[model samples]
Target: MSNITNQSLSEILESINSKKISSLELTQAYIKNIENAKKLNAFVTTTFDQALENAKKFDNKPNNDQLLSGIPLAVKDLFCTENVKTTAGSNILNNFVPSYESTVTKNLWNNGAFLLGKLNCDEFAMGSSNETSFFGNVINPVGDHLVPGGSSGGSSSALAADLTPATIGTDTGGSIRQPASFTGTVGLKPTYGLCSRWGIVAFASSLDQAGPMTKTVNDCSIMLEAMSGFDEKDSTSINKKKESYSKNLKDNIKGLKIGIPKEYRVDNMPKEIDELWEKGKKILKDLGAQLIDISLPHTKYALPTYYIVAPAEASSNLARYDGVRYGYRSQKGKDLIEMYENTRSEGFGDEVKRRILIGTYVLSSGYYDAYYLKAQKVRQLIKKDFDDSFTKVDAILTPSTPSSAFKIGEKTNDPVSMYLNDIFTVPVNLAGLPALSLPAGLDKQGYPLGLQLIGKALDEQKILNIGYAFEKNCGYKNEIKKWWS
Candidate 1:
């Protein structure tokens, strides 16, 4: 039997179909990887026993060509799993297990994908690094104790460290892409409403869309095929007819209209990231793609706007965490108000508290119109920037981050530095566009950096195709990430 550790999902499934391997054996391989790579802290909770039992069922049953059938996947803890403790990397939900499964999870399970575990994440999907989790920091596994970008940090770390072949992550402001850049993997945040947000815990309702994170673009394409589509439960979910992402996987990039966002090359961007961007453009040009200059002039306002809008919405959405309901409750409080305050104070991590404070402040009565309303107008302007840019370019490209992953504690004391991690990705969320981050090159510290492709709204497939094509051209596939070992 082939060792499942190094095998792709498609390869594993093909082996399973031919009786060369059993689902039990395949699941065991990943379970073993999880045990061996314990230092990375990729998962919040595991379900090996449940997975083994399911694999046993698959062994006795029929085999089919389901895309993810028998393939092991770790979901970000943000998604609700029936009866699983989905902490969402927060102590607030430490003992809170959802009685109902999320729509995205149901879709994966229904498609025959195997669940190895629920991975760790930033608290409420708020932070850029996984350090905010109550579960502790997710070590880069790539080398130094660098940050694994978040709130999908565990998802990308799992894939990069070979703990899982693929996993799903939600991106509000580069949660998927930034992590992918940090870990050197392929992560896609589908266009707004392309993937059903139903059942996935919401951070910013309009901005959050779940997508796949995988080691390769092909793996990304395979997983994405199952991750998307419409759901009635989520009113924002688009009812698009599903298409085969693999069909466009091999599309030629010749004459492809790749746009370079002139505004994203902010003066503050590190020179190394600029070099990586240059390399990406050269690779595309070498592949016969014509690079066009595009402008998203409102890009400068994305950070401030996202901070105001997301927090205002989050402050309102997170109000459900009151002590009376689920999550941690304060047993010592004499009154309801005290209970709420005490519980929240103790349950949430520092970052989560900071965001909640910011959110609350923005949404507070006197501040709403000044911060929230103005942010809304800026949000529209950011969206308009993309709308205007698309008229000149087929797809826009930019460095996924200002720089590569930073040391674990380097940015912790400086909240501004931590927030800057999402600088490049924030605009996409503000506009609710599809953006994919793929490993491009390495930085001076030898950490992997990434290049991003922002496609038209509801046009996730094109972004993937562009990433797949560029990945082939750049040929840096595992070079930057392989240093982790």
Candidate 2:
């Protein structure tokens, strides 16, 4: 592997600014890395020509004031990149290219970051594993046959494999953080509405939020600062001034109150996961941060509530992908209705179809009150639970996942088993909070284990500070061999 692949995002930017490496040279090195890493299936579409062109353009300008000047990164295919194909990992929009770019991607570009390509994800961002992608499952860089958790699997895989310095991912129920945990990378799911959703393909509008995946918490803070702002185009976009999160990442945690929710203690969890949780608590306690035992009494119902609410929103949002306007259309359909039916049946993967069906069923007339309505109420209660808890604590600490990354095909046959992977993560989304996953240590199999730091809405800087303190003391190194190379 080239030495360039080992550099952090900030290091790369510094190298570019100091004339140690030209933008074109660095971009070409990453393009070469992506070319050699095809076996990982991390990229759905490679934009080498455009990336090189942009690199050359930035090289000509040489602006030191730009935030991410000459930086090479990848965006998850869920984000529209103006003329680049945004697949969302489903055949339904296999050839769909947007005339406009998502606000998040545009923000990165405006700050002088150029794209390497579009990363793969779950079909309509539906699956916990990247297996639901029409392209293929993204293989974890740590182990040959292990799965990189999804629907942002490709983003996480690319970051871990060093194909890109950093990448963007969307987290709807652990899509970003889970994959980051699996791959031993850092990922953040910013508070809902912190980053605008305009032009990104929506899975569940209420739950989906864009965040950065990188090698360190500092990179996450910088990227989150760059990507977040108010956008009048997106109704849910928060109308708050952009925060200098990177500047505020102090590693001071003394006297900060951290909450440990008792409901997170699920049964049959791996002993290693429990041990890691205890280890994380000790690390925080030793730093003089108070750890209080708290109860999120409604946590047990989070998964079920998410299933109903997310699918209902997904069913509504995805209804526009019929054979009429754009995307993949069916040639076998005889008439309009049949065209709609056949188009969806042929284009959607089984997991996406399943969610759409469940969504539709829950939103149906008679069952609406019983399922979707009830789930919405439960969702509010979940949010309220966090609201009540946050009054007593500054942040919450939990395990990112129930266990380490499983093999690619380990739980494919059991949908419920797959759903349980996001058990610890779902509640954060339910409450529209900011949460981050950082490498804590290696598991017994030498794969990475993650510790999650969740904060109240828009309190990303606090959790990031805590994560930085933990990272400094944890001594967790995310070094992997050039297996893909």
Candidate 3:
């Protein structure tokens, strides 16, 4: 058989439905690719045996009508997969296996999608660089030492390396978009509540959202449609009919008003990012999009406010793993209190602990009103900024990250610098809007740089349309040489 691993998700699906390729053959190809690309370390656990069994069952009676029947993809370690090890890239949950599946993954399986395995991520999805992952940082396929972005680093890296045709990732303050930006992949963070969060390991309940990270824009739309829906089990899940985003994609942006937020022009941005932004603007303008300069004035405060709010929720949600429940526990503690403290202290990485401390401190009585409350107020202003801009423009455009992928360990010592990677992406999550990162151009070092499209709440179709137009006209490509093989 030909190298099916190099084909796009849509192509693979078409071939499968035509009976030209079986899911079992495609699954085996990906498994072989995963085994050969171990140097990237994109996966936390590889479910090769289970994936083959599932593929064999599907091949027996293929359902061509289903949305994702016989398709294989990887799930980020954050989502709970029944009977599969679902570690949120932390040693605390190294042995954790969910008896129940997360709503997002369950929906995919119901549509006949097979899981390749669990992808790596930052410890509890807290960091911008994948270096914080307890499973070890996922290496960028573009460069030997370059970081693949975080906390969805593994998801992005795997897709870029062709180890998986598509993958799912969570966006908690740019975990999905930033990594997609670095890896030159397409990642969508759907409107908050569009996808159910139940059974997913919580990092920040309010900000965390499950979305697809794929090689192409159409794949993202198809994956999003399959993964999203209402779930009574999750209070935050929106009760509405799922959208057919894939069917709605079109390569036309005639007369669409695209907003260019002035506040996104951060200080000391690299020339390549600025150029890529300009290139994107030119592409949209050429396609008949009316580019309007808009101001999201409160954007400056988004990162600071997000730091306070996300950590606060994370601290609360993570308190469940205090050694009394499932997950890691300290064997050296003599007392209950000591065991709780020791277990967390040893289990969590430095970045996760840092956020937890910041979270706990802000929520404490002495600082609750001063820090956490004020941050909440600022968050509203951030949302209001988007709300005001969207009224005038159909979509907003900006650089996904300040720069392209940097070498691993370059910013591990400086947390602030690492946090800056998500400066352009955090506001969208804070405002609970849908955003996508698509490959736009390559930096001077040949690393891929991405541009983002921000849309109104629950209006993913518009952004996907805009992205599809850009992808067709932009001529940007994401292929990389197989250095890890």
Per-residue accuracy of model 1 over 335-386 as CA lDDT, tens digit each: 8898999998998888878888899998888988999889999888888988
lDDT at residue 317 of model 2 (Cα atoms) = 97
Give lDDT tens digits, candidate 2, residues 1-485.
24877888888878888988999999988888888999999999999999899889888988877779888888899999989898999899998988999999999988989889999999988988899999999999998898999999999999999899999999999999999999999999999999999998999999999999999888898899889999999999999878898888899899999999998888998889889999999999999999999999999899999999999999999999997888999998678999899999999999999999999999998999999999999999999999999999999999999999999999999999999999999999989999999999888899999989999999999999999899988989887887876
The sequence of per-residue lDDT tens digits that candidate 3 reaches over residues 1-485 is 67898877888888999999899999999999999999999999999999999999999987889889898889899999999999999999999988999999999999889889999999999888789989998999999899999999999899999999999999989999999999989999999999999988999999999999988889989899999999999999899987899998998889999999998888999987889999999999999999999999999899999999999999999899897779999897889999999999999999999999999999999899999999999999999999999899999999999999998889999988888889999999999999999999998788999999999999999999999999999898777999778
Candidate 1 matches the true fold with a TM-score of 0.97
Q: For each candidate, C-alpha RMSD in Å?
A: 1.7, 1.1, 0.8
Q: Which whole-number lDDT from 0 to 100 does residue 60 have in model 2?
A: 90
Candidate 1 lowest-lDDT run of ten: 476-485
TM-scores for every candidate against the unseen true structure: 0.97, 0.99, 0.99
Give the poorly placed runs of model 1, Cα more than 4 Å off.
479-485
Against the true structure, candidate 2 reaches a TM-score of 0.99
Model 3, runs deviating above 4 Å: none
**Model 3 alpha-carbon miss at residue 4, Å:** 1.1
